[model samples]
Every structure is written in structure tokens, then in C-alpha cells.
Target: NMIEDSEEDTHERYEVEILSKENRRIPAEMVVESIECRGEPGKLVIIRDLTREKQAEKELKDTQTFFEKIIDAIAEPVMVIENDFRVKLLNNAARELLPGNSETPFLCYKISHGRDTPCEGKEHPCPLVEVRNSGKPEVVEHVHQTNGKERYVEIVASPFFDSDGNFVGIIESMRDITERKHAEEAIKKYAKELEEVNRLKDTFLDIMHHDLLNPLGTAMGYLDLLMDTEDQEIKSELEVVNRNISRAIDLIESATRLSKLQSKNSLELEDINLREIVDRCIENFSYEASKAGMKIENRITQPISVKANKIIEEVFSNLISNAIKYASEGTKVIIEAEEKENSLRIKVKDFGKGIKDSSKQEIFERFRRKEKRSIKGSGLGLAIASRIVELHSGKIWVEDNPEGGAVFVVEIPKK
Candidate 1:
């Protein structure tokens, strides 16, 4: 009976071995004997699938490395804070912005103020608290002093959330706007100086034009008397002189008007019918257009109105006259107006040689001319026009026309 029982037990053990081998499972007997000798019986002996576990571990390591790289790569100072306002993570940029003794923990709020007092217990809590409570990003602009240098920093704080939709903490970013602020201030100062210089120039021109008028009038009177005498050769010479003097006087007057328009000053506003203003401009330039053998066409239909100064007339006159001067003889110049939702758009189209793209940006600047030096112009027309448009709270730009030419469009607010 004992021999038979041993045979049966051996058969059962062989069956178990066959099953384990088929499934590629580790043999229990190999591990069990070693474990039995140890004191701890409840200890776990896990045979993990090394392939999957190693892949997961490598992926986790890669994610951590990527996060660290991103944090270090940011140019602005970044800090991560916990709900209790303790510093959790800070980048290299933050350390450089607020460096101190290695033994001391770098507290951002405290270091920003350069105060010895802790930010947590101070009279004014850290601004980040407001951002956390409001659940929205908050921005504050202030001057910060560090290492005996003052800088303007714009602090931005935004709330962070976890995967479970719990409020985790806040991420704070600080940027130095000192250089941009300084540049803006310098521009304003320069604009003021230019304004003063322009005023002085206008005053000088006015005085000179006024002084020249008296002698020019006397010359005109003497030339008229010479014409009355009818000495053919002398009369012809006097007529030429008279014509040249008239041209000079016209130039002086135009310059005076342009100086007034280009002055860095505000305009007196009144609600006026824009159509009527455009009509008067067309009429003023009609004779000049005829002399140039150019035809003027108006496409404006409705009565568009805007709050503007009387200088709008001069602006259009100068633009139309330029269109006439540069266009081919007998080419048509079209003035069109359309009413926009909040603004009035007026366009002056000329079939002249279109300006090059390189020169378009600088054409509105003072003393810029596309024509050759021989072209009789002081190069102040477009500059004066731009200044007048600015005073009227308007914008002007140039674009290429579909039909081989250029279009100058002026947009002014309706109200």
C-alpha cells in the first residue's frame, strides 16, 4: 500500500511539472526551498515582466527630463508655489534674478522687495494670493530693486489644476520691461523736441514770407506800368519776370499753408459734410488739372459726414495736385468715397508710375520724393498730408491698384 501511494504522489507531481513547463512559468520548487530557509515567510517574490516594466520606467525618466529642460529653457523667471505659498520649484532664471547666500532659501516675494521681513507674515501678503483666490491670472507692474539697480518687472500669476480638477497651486512668471519702457519714454522726449523745432521753423518761414510780400507787390506794380507802355521787347521781358514772380509767390503761399498743416498740434473739430469739402477741393484743383491736361472724376454719391478740421480740404488738394503732376498727360484721376460701418473711406486713384515696394514705407516721411532731383518740389507734400490726417484722427495708406497704378486710401472715423 505504501509503494502504491508513493507512485500516485509522483504521478501528480509530474503532471504539475508538465503544466508549468507548457505555460513557461518559473518552477515553484526552485524558489520555495530558498525562501523556506529565510526567517520571513510572508515576503513577496514577484517575477515582473521586465520588458514592460523597463519600457515604462524609461518613458517616465524621459518625461521628467523633458519637463526639466523646458523649465530651464524659459527666458523669463518662473516659480512654482504650493497652496501655502512655499516655493516648490524655481528655474535657473529665478536663481539668477534673485541670488543670495547658498545657505538661505530663496524667497521670491521677500527678495523682490529687498526686505528682511518674510513675505508670508508681512502687512501685505504676496500678490499671488489674490490670483489663487480669484482663480484667474493677475498681472502687476512695478519697479523692483536688486543689486543697486532698479528695473520694471511685470509679474503674471496663473492658477494650476491637477488631473482630478483640484486647485493645485499657481505658476508665477516675471518679465523685465525696463528696456521697452525706457525706449518709449525716450521716443516721447524726442517727439517733444521735434515739435519745438517744427514750431521754430514755422515761425521763421512765416516771418520771411511776410517780409518778402511787400517787395514782391512793388515789383508787380512796376511790371504792370511797364506793360502799359507797350515797348514790345521790354514788355516781353517784363511779362516773363512777372510770370516767374507769380510762380514764386504761389510757392511761398503753399509752403506757408503746408507748415501750418504739418504743425504738431491738435485741430479744432466741427461736424462737416465730407462730400461738400471734397467738392470744394475738386473745384480748387479743377483749373490746375485742366492746365495739366488731366481729367478729374468723382465717384462719391451720398453725403458722408465727419468731425474734422478745415485742413481736410488742403489734404485732398495736395493729394489731387500730386496725382495730376505725376500722371501721364490726359490720364483720368478718380476720387471715390464710401461709407464704412464706423469710418469713412476716401480713395484717390492715379494712373502714374506706381511707387516701388522698398520706397512705400518711407514715402510719408519728411523730404522723401520718388521723382528725380530735377523734379521741382520741396518734397514736403506727403509729409504735410500725413500730419494733417493724423491731426484729424485718420489713417492713410497706399496700395497697388488692379489696373496698373497706385491708390491712396484715407480712413477717418465717422463721429
Candidate 2:
């Protein structure tokens, strides 16, 4: 306003909002200039209708804002890193994990780890490099120390490509797993403690068993001498004593044998007669069975040879004991064997109470027992037997007795 004529007419462009004849505001861009070539005196004015352009720009801005909000709404931290390992796009969750200071670079390593370069070496291996090389997704777990505290995070990374399908960069998703890591470590520690406790228990049993065997042997020896006196009363009393002493010894020995079988991974295999084992076990249990007024039927008369050890005898002993112990007054236990192409099958069936379907497999586990059963046992019989069968590369399972009781089966392969 103070320049008077101002040496000539000035040229300028202006953005202006104009009210159209329809009474609607429209955006416009105008250029004004004085057209003078020494004699011309008119001024030139040009106007551009920028309403459509402005509308388009506003719509694009809204769409970009909507997408950014959606990305930030996700719970897990997500980030997109360029080929040069610079952070390109990150959501709100990612921002919280990275440095917030203005001086920190946008590069992923620098923002998240305060490192000048990408992860390197075993201390901090970057999974993004693996994705770029393999063109496949990769997951890695890392212990991150930030803000004076350590936490574990698992990162899953995948290769990113441009719209044209050209390999460009990587996108990563990360989750904090510090609590889960702590839980796993606690489980491992408890397992170690349990294993040590079992070892100590077995050692104590061994020491006590060795000291008791000597006195038990002396009592049995004195009873055998008294039986030769030919006095009927003394002989009968001696018989009862000998039977009870033998039973105690068998019980002690069973505990030790069970412990030994559990600690071993394999059995010593040899040429063994399974039928002989059954016959001997039947004779061994004859006294108890007769006392309970029960008879055992040994249907396996034919000799079946298998690649097994003396532990095979213990297997049969346990089966027969279970049958006689669980069978009633007049019920008989039947020992049956079938020969197969790959193995031999033996069943010890009792007619009293068959195991519940739910407890059939569980009874073969250590210290597991059926509810409301009065029969006393250490509950380690079938576990030791199953282990032996497994060591011989065979299988053992029990089936419901169609008659009335459980049919205990054992199978071994011929060498």
C-alpha cells in the first residue's frame, strides 16, 4: 500500500475460498499479473477450480489415518524393517518397546537395542538376516535387557516384498515370554529333585535289606533242622514258621527287584523256557493257593522258548501272585500261552474282580492302585513286569475277562 505504483504490477498466485452462486463454499487457486509491454494497460487474472483436488487429498488423508489406527490396535508388537535394517513402519506396541527419545535413530537396532548396527554374533543373532537369506519365516528367542531389567522375547520374522513381488525387507512380530521361561525352569528343577529323592529311597532299601537277610536265613535254617526231629507237632509248627519266613523273604526281595528293574533300561536276554517259568511259579505259589482253597490251572504245557532272562521268572511270579491274591475261595487261575509268528502270548486270568476299564492301564504304573480294594500290595508288580517286557522289545496289556475276572497277558518274541 505504501509503494504507490510499485514500479510495475506485481505477479502472484493466491489460494482463495469463494462462495458459488449455489451458496456453497468452493476452494480455488488464482494467478494475477499485469500484462504490460510498454503500452498494454490491462491486467490478467487466471483461476483454477481446486475443489476436486482438495477433496481427493482429504479422502486420502482419512484412509491413511484409519489404517494407522488399525495397525496400532493390535496387541502384539509389530514392525516393518527396510532392506537396510531401518525401521520403516511400526505400531503403538512396538513404539512402547523401543526408545522414545528424539535423538534415537529410526533404525530397528538403534531404537530397540540402542545399538548402532543390526544384531550380530551369538549374543544377539538377528532373525531378519535369516529371513532375507532363506526367503522364509524364522522365529528366535532372545533375552533382552532394557530399562535395567531382563525379559525374554520371542520374535517371528518373515520376508517382505514390494507390490511388484521384488524382495524388499522384513516384517516382524514379537511376544514377551519371560513368564513362560520361568515356569519351564521351575519344572526342570522339580524333576531333578524328584529323581534324587527316588535314588536315596532305593539306597536306604538296599542297606536295610542286606542286614535283614542274614537273620532271616538263620531262622529258616533252624526250622529245617527241627523238621527232621520226626515229631508231628513240631513238624507242623515248623512248616507254618518256614512258610511265613519264606513269604517275608519274598516280599523283601520283590521290593529290591522292583527298584532294580526301574533303574535299568534293558534286560539281559538269553535262551529261556517260558513254560518252565510258569510251571515253577505255579509250584511256588501252590502253598498259598492251597491255604486259600484255590487251584491254579497251568494250561501252558508245551515249552515256549524266548529271548529273555531270569527276570522272565519274576514276570510270571507277579502275574500268578496277583491272580491268587485277587481270586476268591473256589476260583481257579488259568495260565494260557499262545505261539505267534513274531512272539509268544501268555495270559493269567483270575475269576474274582476284573480291573475297571479306566484303571487297566494305570495299574501298570508305579504306586497306582484301584479304589476301595482290600488286597494289600506294594503296587509295583505290573510296572516292573511291563518294563521287562518293553526291554525285550515286546508288548504287554490286560483285557477284560469274558468269564468274570482280568486276563493278564504277556508276549515275548522267539529269538
Clashes of each: 0, 0
Report the alpha-carbon TM-score of model 2 versus the true structure.
Answer: 0.68
Angstrom error at residue 195, model 2? 4.2
Q: lDDT of model 2 at residue 65?
A: 93
Candidate 1 lDDT: 0.74
Give the whole-model CA lDDT for all candidates, comma-separated: 0.74, 0.81
TM-score of 1: 0.50
Model 2: per-residue Cα lDDT over 197-260, one tens digit each:
9989888878758977779999988888878986889888888788778767766776787777
In candidate 2, list every pair of residues with a backbone clash.
none
Error of 2 at 189 (Å): 2.0
